[model samples]
Target: MPIDWSPLKEIIDQQNRFVLTSHVRPDADALGSELGMALLLRSLGKTVQIINPGATPAHLQFLDPDGEIKSVHDAPALKQAILECDVHIVLDTSAWGQLGEVGKLMQKSTTQKVVIDHHVSSDDLNAIQFKDTSSPATGCLVYDFTQAIDHTPSARAASCLYAAIATDTGWFRFPSTTSKTMRTIANLIDAGANPAELYTLLYEQAAVPRLHLSGIVLQRVATACHGQLAYTYVTQSDFARSKAHPADTENLVNQCMTIAGIRAAFILVQQPNRKYKVSLRSRVDFDVTPIAEQLGGGGHRQASGAMLPGPKDAALKKLIQLFEEELKKQPPAEKNH
Candidate 1:
């Protein structure tokens, strides 16, 4: 299914100074899409600034060698940019809550904003939104946008697009990955992406904290529904013991699905504010996006999440019950083999 990019292209052509941003706790896709789009816009002689609510994770800093992503400390600078820029290009996510302070600023600013995302939207931004749930990653959309504008991205832009699509599709292993996604990725590689280096930088250069945190989370995994559902959680204590930031725990939840018969996986991490941040994953059967939506979040079928209030054990227990209830409603044909 091809996305009609004319509206987005029209908006981009109309704008000059642009601000690019993404969801908080920026993932590779979020940061990658922003960087990739910024590169494209700059190539067209548009002034672009990539302002994010959080710092780039240590693992993903390789994408920006010059420290291009602006953080909370640069809020003052972003304020000026927001006032002066003609448009805001929100990437990867459409949830205002996920955008943190950047969302608030965009809301208050008079400047026009557009969302270039590939998520189950959390709210109606009432702005020009080019959202396609079927696209594996917003980087894919960004790639399409470059093509629509008749510009070939430089090697730098291609590498950023590669990271964006690669991470969002779980290195092309997730069900969201499609034939078109592969072709788009191939184009990036042809344009000068080094897959081996990207794999090593994105997956291999993990700090000790991530491995330590993974052990703590994995030890707590428990199966339910005849081992069809596997769930585990990380508490504040685990973070303290491991000295791991939330970003370090990326992809840890997917570990649960590695076990045979576990069709759905959940990772509940206790945040500093006493809220439980849940990361949901599905194998070949379940669609956890609706599950996350019911719990005040939205995302793809095989990957989604939400934040839950209450104590860790209590919240986890409630969600597990909900998961079981959801599974019972599904048709038998959807069950994993």
Candidate 2:
């Protein structure tokens, strides 16, 4: 069912305390939307508390200039905060599973539940779900929601939203991005977001280890399907050697797609317990969503991901086979007969 926000607005108007959360191992879209909405609600005289399953990535610390986001590692404190809230807003992620185990408590609460997300698969979650998969980023939806309620978004809110839109759309380079996305970004800029500063912080501010890790990842890049598809895997040992945090792997898949002949790219990062986190990127007409769904995950066509539970080599082999199968499914290019 399509979402109706009037009831949610009424609940917000009557509520005094609000809790905001997003998915675990959050990206800029998740963290930014969480913080942005929290700030907007706070401006409306609501006591807003932002919570997440883990710590914010170091690169995103700029979003929380006041350092207000609380992690679930401090569950005792976060539980108290959750108890105080009359409403809970889950951002970026739709399913409670994305929140990790801590979110189960939020799911059980009788408090009004509101979800703001842009993922296509999130519509099935329990809440007053406000989802627009057509929107380039959840941040765009968040911006519209704030304006719909006539709330004057704070600079922090605008900046966070800006970051969310920018990161999720690959700096306005993805096909999902539209003129409206550009205009939305312009509005955020007018509302006081500093694009130059944000660009520097998100991309140029990487640490030495992250840069070295990127070099290693590029050196090992492998291509398939006549160079139409490419993949790279980073083992646990690679991280230890470079002293790179898992978060450092963010946006690494995009690098593989930079090759002129590549239409799709994949990156499989080895995680604890022999599990692998797979990220996919596509250019032009290729859709990767079905590939992710086949592996028990979901995301947009051009940008999707999944997790494989097995040894790195085995997982990579399986992924390569799957990739080959998907490529065969695509119609052969038109031949000048």
Candidate 3:
């Protein structure tokens, strides 16, 4: 199906002031798309302000060389910018809950709303939403937005977008990586993305405290449904003990799936507000999107996540049961594969 970019293009032409945002606890794709689009907007002489509900993860902060992303608190000026913007662009997420405080503020804003994301839409915000779950990352859609508007990205914009696509698709290892996705990355590299440097910053660089936390996370990995399902968790206490930031746990789910014979993996991370951030990953012949959606989340077939409104222990126990039940529904022949 042809993507309808006219709605977003119209907004770009008609408006000069834009506020860009993403979901809380955003990953590379979210920030990448935000920063890349912000560069495009500024290049066009359109004023841009990036206001995220949460802070950027330290590992990915290099994308913001000038430190443009601001939390609603850190930048008091964001209130006025958001309130008086000609358009508000929400990136990488469509769910109201994922948007956090920004979601609440968006409901009250009468200005034009635009959503650019790559996840399966669970909530319709009645806006001009552009989503293609087929794309590896939201940054791909943002790149397309620029192209549709006839705006060539700057070298910095290309690097930002390349990092976004690279991280979300697991450095092109994930099954979601497409020919178009690779082509986009090639163009980004041609524009200026340094693959070697991005890999070092995104994956190789980690604080000593995070290593301590990883040991704790690995020891706790548990299996269920005859070892077909693997699950792990990181508590707030764990972070406190290791002196690690919450963002340090970002890629722990990938580790949970490294074991042989594992069909799926889930990580329940305890957030500050008593809620748990659930990350799910699928292996061969498995799709965890249903599980994520059941728990009030949505994403791709291979990866998805949700936020639990209960305690971590309770959510962990409950999810164990659900995952076991899901395993029972799978074909016996598929389990050993």
Candidate 4:
């Protein structure tokens, strides 16, 4: 069912000050949704500020070139503003764990709270929620909100949202992409978004260290469960050796899926704290969310992630075991012979 945005509209009409936020280690969808929402609210002459649990990843800083989006810790002065806002809108993620420190502050705020998300996993944040799991990206939900208000995003806003929807849907190649998704993209372009320029900025601007990191990750790829599962890992040492930042690990898991006969893929990237951030991906007929949710993380069926306590080798074993068990539940592939 389509979300009734009338209540949200009413909230916007009644509210003056708004603070926007999203999950930690924010992605294009998260940042894009915040930018899109901020623009929509600001267009109505409402005051808006974008804050998040963490700094915008280095790669995604282009989306917010003005540095308007600030990390919670970086902006101590905004704490009062956040709490005093007329409305607090959490976008892209519903899980409190995903929100990190920002979530902690939100818990104490007496202001009206709202959640706009598309993820299946959620926690009660004591907010009115507008969620559509069918929507490929939270950017889509933001677009729907703009339509409800009959507003066109500015060029920058359009570009941010375009990046959000494009990346989350794997450039419209993911199964989640639909005719409606493309229609939304069309509207964004009509509103002044340039897809080619945005794509080059996003994918083509990779630093040399990123490529070095990718080479290391690719070399470590391994297959198991009769080649039905492919997996890889990036250690903290790998980052040091390659001079790559943690953000460079993005999309490395997808490289695992390039292997023939692989139905599922995962990449474990070691964090500074020695924890492993495991990104899981799968083809049709396989679901990765259950595993992610079990580990206290969540996302879509084909793409989900979790953080596991790590002694690197131990984390790998646990994930491999889980994937092996999940694979057993599926019917065996017929022999080529």
Cα deviation at 291, candidate 4, in Å, is 6.2
Off by over 4 Å in 2: 1-4, 122-125, 235-246, 268-279, 287-300, 303-321, 332-337
Please, what is the whole-model Cα lDDT of each candidate in the order they appear? 0.85, 0.83, 0.85, 0.90
Which 10 successive residues of model 2 have the least lDDT summed? 118-127
The candidate with the higher TM-score, 1 or 3, is 1
Tell me each candidate's RMSD, in Å, in order. 3.6, 3.5, 4.0, 3.5
In model 4, the Cα lDDT at residue 313 comes to 88
TM-score each candidate.
Answer: 0.82, 0.84, 0.81, 0.85
In TM-score terms, which candidate is top? 4
Top model number, lDDT = 4
Cα shift from native, residue 67, model 1 (Å): 1.3
**Weakest ten-residue segment in model 4 by summed lDDT:** 327-336
Candidate 4 per-residue lDDT, tens place, 1-337, comes to 9999999999998989999999998999999999988988888999999989989988789998899999988868777778788999999988899988888888997889999999877496899999998899999999998988888899888998999999999899988899999999999999999999989988899789999999988988999888899999999899999999887887788888988888999999888888889999998878888889988998877889999998888988988888888888765567588
Error of 3 at 79 (Å): 1.2
Candidates 2 and 3, the one with greater TM-score: 2
**Candidate number with the higher lDDT (1 or 2):** 1
Residue 58 accuracy (lDDT) in model 1: 73
